[model samples]
Target: MFVESVVRWGAWSILLQFGLGVSAGFCPPRCACRPDTMEVNCSGKHLTSVPESLPSDMKRLDLSQNKLKTLGRRQFLGLTQLQEMDLSDNVISMIEVEAFQGLQNLRILCIKNNRLKIIPVGVFSGLFSLQFLDLSENEILVFLDYTFRDMGNLQLLEAGENDLVFISQRAFTGLQNLQELNLDRSNLTSIPTEALSQLQSLTRLRLLRLTISSLPNNVFRRLHRLRSLLISHWPSLDTLASNSLIGLNLTSLVISRSNLSAVPYSALRHLVYLRYLDLSYNPITSIQGNLLGDLLRLQELHLVGGNLLRIEPGAFRGLTYFRVLNVSSNQLTTLEEGAFHSVGNLQVLRLDGNPLACDCRLLWVVRRRFRLNFDGRQPTCLSPDMVREREFQGFSEKELPRVFICRPSRIIDRRRQEANIEEGTNILFSCKADGDPAPTITWISSQKTLLSPTGRIRVLSDGTLEVRYAQVQDSGMYQCTAGNAAGNDTLSVSLQVKGFPRNRTMPFFTEQGWIESSFPPTANSSAQVANPYPFDAKTLIIATTMGFLSFLSSVAICFVFMFFWSQSKGQIKHTATIDFVPRASMGGGGEGGDTGRFTMKLI
Candidate 1:
């Protein structure tokens, strides 16, 4: 009986030890744990504190979508094997300094979608192996200096979509190997140029929703290796400094949905290797001349939903390898063929959603419509009552002559304009014309100088000629010439400055007509005419000059008489004869043109 009891006890002891081993490896309550894979998923649990009894050997922990409000120090003390932790979408507002301490193997930490107003330093301490850190979608207002100083191996940081206004210059100090940083959709007043330059290995940056008006010079000189940059939704952005992007070797750049009124030609002249550019939803009214000649390797260009009126010839002169162009949803009536002649390598052309006139100006596009891909939305006619709403490619070549007709540019108000203006006053000449393709108005000055948009004489935006502080030299027939591909028209505007200067200070009209003065008038000097005095201004000048000459001759005679009397007193026999030689005898000139000689013989 004693042997039987001892054996039974030994069997029970073995079974109890086996049960204890299985209990140690059991899954936590209300949690799914794959002990084989070492991952714990406790997401969406309503418990306020961190889930208890998490597997000790788990490599990934997801505690997101919980009501946890604060993270206490040493909360995750034993999670040494954790390689990734997701604490996003929680009401976490405060984080003790040592909350994530000893997470040396954590490679990814995401604290997004939280109510974090500030992330004090030392929160990310001892995370030596972390590669990606996401602090986006939070209420963080500022990033203190050295906030991420301990995360030396961090490679990517996404802190966009936050209420960030100011960031310390050393906020990203130790992130030397960081390659990508995104601060898009934030309320940053300006680009944190100094703060971002510390990332020595940064290659991509995104900054959107800025409120700056102009980019100062050399803003990106320190970000030397940046390859792609995206800047959008800056409605107040207008002027981009010419040297703003001087040091970057960017391959792609985007500046969209802004208030830019024209192509920043001078600003983009140095982006020689830039291949992709996007300038969509801007207020750019036109693209004129060879403005984009410097972008040699450009492959794609975008200018969608803009206010484009016309694209002048040679606009794409040097984009030899250009492949795609998108200028949809604009106000262009027609595109002159020369606009795309230099872009022969174009494969995809998007010119739809525009008010096309279906005129001869767009025949070149219709001829090549079959060869070029329109990207689903083809060009549609908006004019020529018969062809309105008609597809561009539907029209046959035989039907083009009647539908695609052009009208020669003509001066609607064809009459010579004559005006008399006073000096020191501003004057404007109005010229009106019409044509199939809008005509360009040019004004030629009386001095045969082309009137530009600046200087004393200039052309206004409405094609009116403005002369500021008019002078007498500006008083002549000014020509207003309007020309286009169809034809040309011209009219003369006769401007007479100070026509009746002695009468009044302001120019006035007369009953007969604009009386042309045969010559510049002088003060009345005729004796027959009733005058204030016979010696008027001009008459007095001549009389005074003649009297002064006679006085000079009398003084000479007195000198000659005095010299002879002195010689007689000395009993000197002085016989002096002065003879003058003509300049003709000495040829055209002598030394310094001073050959007028006289000789006096004294005996």
Candidate 2:
């Protein structure tokens, strides 16, 4: 009986130990735990502090969106195996020195969107394996020495959107493996370049909307591995010293929306491999040869929405690989010849919203040899009243009059020679001119009749003659006389109408480029026919008959080829069968070889 009691007691103790080990993974109140993954989720709970009874070997802990105010020392003492800890969106104002003491294997720690004001030195003392640390959107004002000295393996440090104004000299002394650093919107006037240069692995840095005014020469030469640098929204930025961007290997540079009256071209001479450059929304006025001389590898350049007025010849001298050039919205009146001579590879050109002068000087743009592709709305003529408001894409030399010359008071009209219309139709004759001052216009006809605004004959505000009804009597030589203080000029136009008058309401031209008459069709033997398109009815009938005959010929040829193809296919099949049978019969039976040979001879 004594031996049995001892055995039962030992068995009961083993059972109790087994039960305790299984219960360790049980879900806690208002919290969850996964035994398979060893993860603990206690997020969105009203817990004032981290729960002490969490699993000791949890790999992930999510304590986000909680009311935790402070992290006491040894709060995570036993969570040595936790790889990721998310304490974001919490009221964590204070973190004791040893708050992350035993988290030697933690790889990611997010304390962003918290109320932390200061990051005490050694706060991240034992997190040797930490790679990413996000303390952004916090109240950290100053960075003290040795604040991040213990995190030697950290790669990314995102402390943007903070109140950081100053950083101690030794604040980043031991962060040798850091790669990316973001300090945007922090109001930092100066950065400790000496300490930052020590980080050899740093490749990307952003200093957006900083308070610094000017950049010294070679300010970023020490950042040897930097590939991207962005400095934007510096409202007071006006000067960039010579060699400011020298001795660096950057691929992208963006300095936009600043107070730069002109680009610091002297400083950008060192960006040899720059592929993307954006300097839009600046107050730059002109582009000269020295501004963007020899950037051979540049691909995209955005200079939209500026005060740019001119682009000197050879402005794009050495940019052979340029793909996009945007210079929209400015007060440009003309361009020198070969302005884009070197940019042969340009794909997109934006030159809209500029007051361009339309004349022989723009023949380069109208020629097919240029082949320029516009990006947005095409430029319209803003001068030489004849072509005013006409898009450059469709303007042609034929639209100019044969004797057209932009004089003080000379009228320009497309129909200066002659015009043809139906007797009962309406027509418009525009006589627009350019002069130093305003010009007055008058109209006269071949029959010595002074034309004025009458029943069916009216003159537009722009001195355009309108004829509502067309009659044989109305068909004659019309002249437009323009007089100004400088001089007086005249332009002649001949109107020819074919057909009898429909009604006798004096025909006048409308602004809609049409002629209207208040007359009924005469439709008598003397009436003439009207042809709207280039070809007459007889020519159209002949073209339609020829097209139908050509189509029938094509179908007939296809049918003939198909008929021959069927006959050829049948002959080939018969020949192939005859050739194949002899070989099979000869190989199968030697005695029947003579029969096969005879058959071949007959074929």
Q: Please give the CA lDDT of all the candidate structures.
A: 0.83, 0.76
For all candidates, what are the clash counts? 0, 14
Q: How accurate locally is residue 157 in candidate 1, as Cα lDDT from 0 to 100? A: 96
For model 1, the local distance difference test gives 0.83
Residues 1-603, candidate 1: write the lDDT tens digits: 999999999985764433221223544555666544666777897758886666566788888998889998878887788899999999999999988887889999999999998998988888889999998999999999999999889989999888998999999899988999999777778778888889888888888887878888887767888889898899999999989888888889899998999999888888887999999999999998888889998889999999998888888887888888899999988888787645458788888999989887887778788988999888999998889999978988889888887888887886767878767678888888899777889999898878999877899987899987676778998999988877899988988886333433433224763233333334642223336776679888899999999999999999999999897787665565565655654446554543354556685
Task: Give residue 355's error in model 1 in angstroms.
Answer: 1.2
Q: Please give, for residues 1-603, the per-residue lDDT of candidate 2 as tens digits.
A: 999999999885764433222224444556766655677788898878788677777788899999999998768998778999999999999998978999999999999899988999878999899999999998989889889988999999988888988878788878898989888788677656666766778888887777788888767767888888888888888888887788778888888888889978888878888888888878999888645766778887778778888787778766778777777777776654456645457677666777876654455555532367786468677877767887767755676442123237767654446779876677888788777444678888778677777646667777888877676678888888887544788888889987745544544456675454565556674454555789988999999999999999999999999999888766442222233334554437554444332223223
Predictions: Cα RMSD each? 18.9, 28.3
- lDDT top scorer: 1
